[model samples]
Target: MSIDLQSKLTPLPRLYKEITLDVGGEAVHLIIRRPPRTVMAMLLSEARKAGELDEQDKPKDGGCAMRLMARMAASVLYAPDGVRPLYDRKNPEVIENLVENAEWLLDIQEDVVGALGANGAVVERIQGNSEATQT
Candidate 1:
């Protein structure tokens, strides 16, 4: 029996406008902005440069300074938390959580792009998974 996989495939769901926060809040709207490719490239380049710095010279945290900056920018755009630690040393668990979250975000991004029929860029596969399932 020849199964028509193309017919079986469904478009991924679009992201929701509002997200519920962990802290008490009614509704939070999402604003999607596509950062310029040049800006993203510059940020990645800076992160690579910062990663090369010696441990003593570098920030105490586990090479999260660049990521922290990006996260801070995102927070400012959405949540607006005034105080953010330069180095999050005590939170090893948080790093793991961030890694997981990053993976999720990447998958969502790829799905969105694929749904929109964009091509050429390579998509990274999720680690330790035999198959990709729709969420």
Candidate 2:
């Protein structure tokens, strides 16, 4: 007897965008995808544990934000040629490579975070659903 292993749910495609960044005088073409919720959750958890905050809200661990930025860059970064992922989120070596290019990585992370947070339409609908549930 064969059981249906396929999911019955419809697939929702993730958002993607392309960009070219100048890294150390080299033109790097990247395809950035909106990070999935799991990656976002991991980012949040990593950020929370990466530093301590006092009343002034100053980060005691200076590398915390940088590490998060590296992770974000790793998560969303993809090669434009075949849409290949340049780095794996689970691999520290690949993440460290991103850290080495901190200057340009910051720019890459900016775009990645923008993609992650750019779901204005979805946010509105989700907020509406929450409001309706509370009513």
Candidate 3:
């Protein structure tokens, strides 16, 4: 029997959420896109460069973790239409932007992380499973 690799290897669905923030007096709309599986490696590389990770690629500290969350939020940010990426993975400007708006990073981080399986939905589902179901 011949196997079809293309049919077996399906891409992960892109996750995103539409958000609105009050920047100054006006409400600014944006899309928070979850980093696609294809760019996970690049994002990790960026985290390392931003000092969020050590040489071993492990998290350095709490502060670094915060920075990483901010970086993730920043890189995944998109235009309100959700089609245009506001920040490019290859652009160093994202780091500068994150630094300049450090105060908002945590807020953004919560939303970004919350979007992940509704913030631990998968874990909760697995944990709620009964022993009989495990069989």
Best by the lDDT measure: 2
The whole-model C-alpha lDDT of candidate 1 against the native structure comes to 0.33
Winner by TM-score: 2
Model 2 root-mean-square deviation: 8.7
- Rank candidates, TM-score, best first: 2, 3, 1
Clashes of each: 0, 0, 0
Which residue pairs collide, candidate 2? none
Q: What's the true lDDT of residue 29 in model 3?
A: 83
lDDT for 46 in candidate 1 is: 46
- Return the TM-score for each candidate structure: 0.30, 0.61, 0.58
Give one digit per residue, the lDDT tens place, for model 1 in 6-85: 43553222322223333234443333323333433343344446462232223224334434333322322222221222
Query: How far out, in Å, is residue 119 in model 3?
Result: 8.7
- The candidate, 1 or 2, that scores higher on TM-score is 2
What TM-score should be assigned to candidate 3? 0.58
Cα error of candidate 2 at position 131, Å: 26
Per-residue lDDT over 14-83 for candidate 2, one digit per residue giving the tens place of the 0 to 100 score: 5468898887899877788776666766754554554432232223344544565676677777776544
TM-score-better candidate, 1 vs 3: 3
Count clashing residue pairs in model 1.
Answer: 0
Candidate 2: list runs displaced more than 4 Å: 1-13, 46-60, 118-135
